[model samples]
Target: MPPRNAARLYPLVLLLLAFVAFPLYWMASTSLKPQTEVFRVPPTFVPETWTLRHYVELFWLTDFGLLFVNSLKVCLVSTGLALVVGSLGAYALARFRVRGKEAYGRLVLLAYMFPGALLVIPLLLLFRQLGLTNSHLGLSLAYLTFAVPFVMWVMRDFFASVPVDLEEAALIDGASRLGALWDVVLPQAVPGLIATGIFAFLFAWNEYLFALILISDESLRTLPPGMMRFVSTTDTNWGLIMAASTLATLPMALAFGLIQRYLVTGLGAGGVKG
Candidate 1:
């Protein structure tokens, strides 16, 4: 592209970023503002009076802390499972000469594209039959439906980028197939793993519909559904809501920040090499 064209698009790109970022900024800002300033006349773009009362109430006076912990457990376990299973499945599909390999690849992508809403009812019933409903294990399993497929699809491409020669050399050195995978291929795929793991964790952490439907016990509520409990017919605590929202967003932001250096390269490296 010409310098003139790039200059013309710069403003539009910044505008789009601002549009997306403003809501998050507003949420964080609102969480810090006192209730009095939340709906003040002319609306304060910046808070004049900051307070931590909402955070105090959210943590000390309510079960939000427990809810946050439950979410973390479910998401962490789900992401781990997804990474293990998806990586193995991806490696098989990439390295092995299996029958209907293309069809199986398409099927994995199709599974990922399936609507979560549509799966909710059947999953609920299935969990009940298995006596896993209302439990964190069941919730993690629910997350696996989508997480596994996403990891598998991304990892399949990533594994394709890894040269067969490396694995063959390891094999000739008397390393078993699994040993070669662990010692040779997996290290090269770290970036892809980190990127995919982030996606899996974020999805499981942020999902509300399945959590709400599957988990009836308040103790098991994740952040998104737990946050919703703040609203009621008689009253809605905006300060508390904003505070909870801010807290819930922090983990995902921190996770992304830690792996961001690898994310871009991890996502693109496979494409370049494959």
Candidate 2:
């Protein structure tokens, strides 16, 4: 509150701002700069002349639109499946006296922690056998393995925070267990569910390694892998790459901004014990 304290905090605040905003500002600035201007002797922070060429080329010459749609589909479907299944599993874990509940939760978290790279080979082989290679559904299914456990852990904490007395009262009023969960418990857990959904969506949307290995067709590629195609061995189109990166990042930015409140709440709830 003192002037000296405020002044001391200003440097940290400025550093944080620079760290977060600099990359985004650079991406936008690079996207607008022409190829010659981009690699000019003295690097220019701002574009001397703005052009829509990169955006135009991206849409017209490349499969960027299809990649964007593909990424969106994977993120949405994967997140939806994760949240629905995770929420129910979390509810049961939190509310019911299932045997080895603690062990099960730990096992789920352990499974989630396994690196995607480790599973890629086996997953690819399995997909090949199932004829699911190059398919969005296959990618979505792969995403679920990581998404579900984190969602379950977060939602279980949220559900546990809501007292069982409310559900008991509903049961006394003749509401079924599922009805009570739908009507009473779920409303209280919206923030957690939204937070989990955002995590799942972002994970599925930005995934690159699995998409790279599983998909061979240009049409089936997601944004991250599709963006890589812009960078070839001989030359890299910096402007177009930046533009594509900007486009890919926008949805995640918008999604986080929308559900940030819930995300913060859910994260905090997960840290505390019921």
Candidate 3:
């Protein structure tokens, strides 16, 4: 690139960074500020006086810890189930020449594209009849509808990129299909698995619409729904709200950082030309 073009691109790059980082910076700043200082007209870049009161109040005055635990449990269980089921389904689709395989693959893709907003009411009613409303199990299962299909489709592509000869040789050596998958194919797909796990985890963690409508009890509420309870007609606590937002986003940041290497690997794995 020419120097002039590179200079022109620098402003755009800075703008993107500012757009993404400013909200996080504001949240963190607000979290540290006193409630009175949060909305001061002459906004201070740094807190004039720092306070841990909001964080303390969030934990003790509210059920933030319990809500965090609830969210964590739902995210972990749903992601784990999605990864296991999606991987197996993906492997079968990629390796086995079943009738209607193409149609089945398209069906899986279609499921991912399906709108969740349209199904929320019916899903709630179904869950109510099944005695799963306001339950963690029900929430996890609902998440699986989207997470499983997404993971399966992504993993199918990843598995297809792997050399089939490796699994074939393992099978020829008296290994069972499952054994070959467990011992041979899985190791090669570790990067893809990490990527899929991250995707599933985020979907389960950040899901709001379903969690909001399905859960009613305060104790059963996940972070998203629990956060909503903070807003009321009388008042809004911006400091505490920002603190909660910052805390809610931390796990996702850590998850992405941990899996970033695997994400890059998975993206690049299939691009090598023969």
Task: Score residue 97 of candidate 1 by CA lDDT.
Answer: 98
Pairs that collide in candidate 1 are none
lDDT of 1 by residue, 25-50 (tens): 99989888898888889888888998
Candidate with maximal TM-score? 1
Regions of model 3 farther than 4 Å from truth: 1-11, 270-274
Q: What local distance difference test score does each model get?
A: 0.90, 0.89, 0.89
TM-score ranking from best to worst? 1, 2, 3
- Please give the RMSD to the true structure for each candidate, in Å: 1.7, 1.8, 2.4
lDDT of 3 by residue, 96-198 (tens): 9999986897698687566889878999999999999989999999999999988888788788888999999999999999999999999999998888888
Give the clashing residue pairs of candidate 3, or none. Answer: none
| TM-scores for every predicted model | 0.95, 0.94, 0.92
lDDT of 3 at 132: 93
After best superposition, candidate 3 residue 101: deviation in angstroms? Answer: 1.7
Error of 3 at 223 (Å): 0.4
